[model samples]
Target: MLKFVKGHMESIEGIATYPMISLLIFFVFFALLFWWVFTASKRYVREMSELPLDENNQ
Candidate 1:
């Protein structure tokens, strides 16, 4: 199965750039997410964290 997949991938033109583009997108998304998490307000984080417990109490 791995050999078949590799053969098909090797046959495709421009397939090499696809992996780089995918990796770039993944890295950028995670970097943005990390920035957001760190920059998010403490109050907002507390409120969001308590949301489930608040619902349970009510």
Candidate 2:
């Protein structure tokens, strides 16, 4: 089954670019997330972290 899929995929031109494009998208998404986490306000982060333990929240 793997051999058949690999053979079929190899026949398609530009299929190699698909993996590169997907990798670029994956990198960009995580980079933006890392930036957000670093730049987020400390107060907001504390509140969010405690939200689950706070029973007052409905």
Q: Give one clash count per candidate, in the order shown.
A: 0, 0
**lDDT on C-alpha atoms for all candidate structures:** 0.96, 0.99
Model 2: worst 10 consecutive residues (lDDT sum): 13-22
Candidate 2: segments with Cα more than 4 A from true spot: none
Q: TM-scores of the models, in the given order?
A: 0.77, 0.86
- Give candidate 1's error at residue 20 in angstroms: 0.5
Regions of model 1 farther than 4 Å from truth: 1-4, 55-58
TM-score of the candidate numbered 2?
0.86
Identify the leading candidate in terms of TM-score.
2
CA RMSD (A), model 1: 2.2
lDDT string for model 1 (1-58, tens) is 9999999999999999999999999999999999999999999999998988795666
Task: Enumerate residue pairs that collide in model 2.
Answer: none
